[model samples]
Target chain A: MIIGALGPEGSYSEKAVQIWILRHRLDSVGIQYFADIEDAFLAVIQKKSDLSIVPIENSIEGSVGVTLDLLHENGVEIVGEIVVKIEHCLLSKGGPEKIKVILSHPQGLAQCRHFLKKYFPEAELRSTGSTSHAARLAGEFEEMAAIASPEAAECYRLKVLLPNIQDRKQNYTRFIALRAAGKNTAEQVFEQVLCDTEEKTNRPENSSHSAFKTSIIVYLEKDRPGALYEILGAFAKNKINLTRIESRPSKKELGDYHFYIDFEGHISDAIIKETLKDIKTKTDTLKILGSYPAFKA
Target chain B: MIIGALGPEGSYSEKAVQIWILRHRLDSVGIQYFADIEDAFLAVIQKKSDLSIVPIENSIEGSVGVTLDLLHENGVEIVGEIVVKIEHCLLSKGGPEKIKVILSHPQGLAQCRHFLKKYFPEAELRSTGSTSHAARLAGEFEEMAAIASPEAAECYRLKVLLPNIQDRKQNYTRFIALRAAGKNTAEQVFEQVLCDTEEKTNRPENSSHSAFKTSIIVYLEKDRPGALYEILGAFAKNKINLTRIESRPSKKELGDYHFYIDFEGHISDAIIKETLKDIKTKTDTLKILGSYPAFKA
Candidate 1:
């Protein structure tokens, strides 16, 4: 089995895959690294990988728009979710006093703005493709430091100058495991993982009763005053709790948008099905991304 | 008057400021440049600049999360808006054949990804602080090309190797003009601009009935099925049209969110005021971020 993920190896997406592997006790999984989230998602669609793990949202940074956009554009189903705690560390070859430049992914740098502003105001900040990429580049320059995970510091053989340097301490990232639509390999793996989880937690075998999340995208036909309100009313009337709601531009114009909503229910549930049926009547287009067991942590 | 904006002088934020100045026919406007959006926003709050202009949303890229977060965090109000059409150009000191590195802001690079992939697949892509910064760097190196505005190419003395190189042609960016709350100078200027607009368009002088947009931030008191729906219901019940609705993380946990909403009608309208009063009762906190005339273009 091959899992596609954003890489060069030490990314948080890889961490999510490790957790998924450990929970399922899977040992034969091969990891394929893609430079960007879209490529990783496309790998699953193209049948090069059985599943793909990509970051969907960060607690501090908000939603990954590209990932959300891809979910709307592609024919993929989310089979599982993983929540990884983000702890950004400042890594360097030498001490902080010698640093002339700071490097990281734009998000890593943005999350630690206060720390950088106060500690190394003179250092030039540079953006790399990924946090791990920043760590690798930091390894070659004694006067450079990187804001990345501790795992990245170890992988690049750099000293941890500062741990948990992000402005907020409650930083976490939610990643989704995606598979090509209509593919059963990932579905079987997800069921096995859920079975293991149920056994460990001593929960019931009925999958419908478990905590599941269903995601869908909706586009309104007209720019009416209450169009979105009426569409959301279906979920409200069904008493379904929404975990997330975000609007992405439809690309037709500035004001036009497509909403991506996540609610706490399985698509197979009778009430969920009925609610979706009602929502479909109110919306011009509605696409169900998937229904998956909610992450416990 | 002094305006704070993101710059090395040729950023899109600067272009927005130029358009605003042209529309208002202001002659004594001076621009103060900041390295990041937060700093530019802070400049207004600190009274270093009379007003600050920052990109709020893009047609293709969606909302600027940091700017929205700042609106929620700071005591600034949106007094005006400007929309700038984006036309990315490939610039270089030498011809395209000599280009080995393509540099631009991350958004610029992402916007022109398809163009670069088909034309210069082997060239290294680098991210700079701004597109103008990339143009300036390209001016110093023959092997470097930049994706920036045509104005940037002229400013940096670089040849425009290709124009309109972005993947999407209908790209537009919405920039908000912000001023410190309780400061009447910006409000007075806004009224002057509105009067000028009414004169040019041959419209009536009733400010309350004009095309206006009001922005607000809402935080639900509890995680319930109908919490957001109820808040949005207030607007729907009043027949107010929402232009945009986006959720940003509250930075407390993964699922916790604060919704930023933009809707038609000014805060001064009787119906709008009543609706907000009703919404305030439904949510834990509701902050009014001011009402401004909607961008016409």
Candidate 2:
């Protein structure tokens, strides 16, 4: 199976996918990467890749809308999830005073906006594709500095001007693993068994399949008032507690939106099946995007 | 007052602020423009400019976290909001077949991702500072296409490959006007008049002040379970009807978040004020970000 990630081979998506491969003991010879989240999603859509890892949200930056919208428009399903800590560092080719500009992804640039404001207030901040690319550019130009990862600074041969410069101390990203429209039963069962075995080694008191969560995206009929309420009524009736729900524009019809909902139970649960049936009865479209182990479970 | 906007003169934010200035009849000489959202925010924070305008959310792209977080950290109040339609065009310095790459601001790039996927599937997509910057780059280079505004295409003398290629039919941006901590009575009175005029223009039959919404950002003390519940309980008691709520990491402390909420009432209402008091009693901090006329109202 081919694996795709967002990268020049060192983005957070790359790291998340690599960690998933290592944990799953999957082969990586046919693995590839793209520079943008949409590219990674399209790779899955076109059957160029079996699975793609893209960031859906970050603790510091909130929602990554591009990923959210692509999942809304396409037939890809989010079969699993992974959380990676975001560690941002300030890198420069020379001392801080020598830097006239700072470069990083717009998200990275925003994550460190406080540090940038407090210190390099006069530097012209710029946006690039990824943190590693920013660090690479900083290494190539004496007047440039980068807000990136420490690993990226070393890889790009740039010195760390300031370490751990993210505005928040505990920033984490929630990335979803996208696969073609159906489930891989063998992979799913194998992952569950592995998780169970791993839990046996050092199980936390809260560890169980019950703790796992599932996310699904649905689109309602046009300008339907109480439409969300009707769809949500199913979950409420089934006692399937919803953890979160957010809306993204459908893009197919003006003002129509896809509702992304997260509930506390897996899709295999009987209650979930009943709830989805009820939702389909009330909504114009219902797409089961994925059933995944939610973050920190 | 010194006003800052995004520009080298003509761009979305520049046009947005200009519309605002014309609507309010403010002076052009008092206005200064920056190359990016952060720069505009900084202009206000550093007292280089007394106020600024930045795009905070788009119908297709959702939240512009850079602007949101910058203002959140810098302690600037969103004095007002303006919704501007986003019309994107594809410009080129080469023929369609010769164009090897497409460049744009990340948001603009994401907005047109569907177009790229369907048409120029093989083109390498790159992101730059702004749409106008991409147009300028296209003017200086060969074999490149830029996803930008028609104004940008005209300004840079680039060929328009396609016009209005955005995925959403009605792509609108919600731009927030910022000022320092305190309120100016004259500006407030003027804004009230403007707000009333806006309501009169857009008021549909069966519309009320409670028809569309109210937005607020709340922060709670750390290590409190059901803190959000208690705060939300106030609204539940009044049946105020919450439309949306989003949580972003509060840079002040690790593992803490500030919840931004949209409910359905003005702060001037008695129940809303009582709700605020109840929420204040239950939470560490509560900042009413703004209670302006909700978009599309």
User: Which number leads on TM-score?
Assistant: 1
Please give, for residues B21-122, the per-residue lDDT of candidate 2 as tens digits.
877787644768776678887787688888788887777776677776765566666656778888999898777778887888778877776788789777
Interface RMSD of each: 1.5, 4.9
lDDT for model 2: 0.70
Query: Residues B37-75, candidate 1, lDDT per residue (tens digit)?
Result: 778888988998999998888888788877988898888
Q: Which prediction has the highest DockQ against the true structure?
A: 1
Off by over 4 Å in 1: A183-205, A208-210, B116-125, B183-205, B208-210
Per-residue lDDT tens digits for candidate 1, residues A258-295, read 99998887765667767876886789888878777899
With a 3 Å backbone cut-off (N, CA, C), the pairs that clash in candidate 1 are none
Q: What is the TM-score of each candidate against the true structure?
A: 0.91, 0.76
Q: Residue A227, candidate 2: how far off, in angstroms?
A: 5.9
Docking class of 1: medium
| lDDT for predicted candidate 1 compared with the true structure | 0.82
By summed lDDT, the worst window of 10 consecutive residues in model 2 chain B runs over B197-206
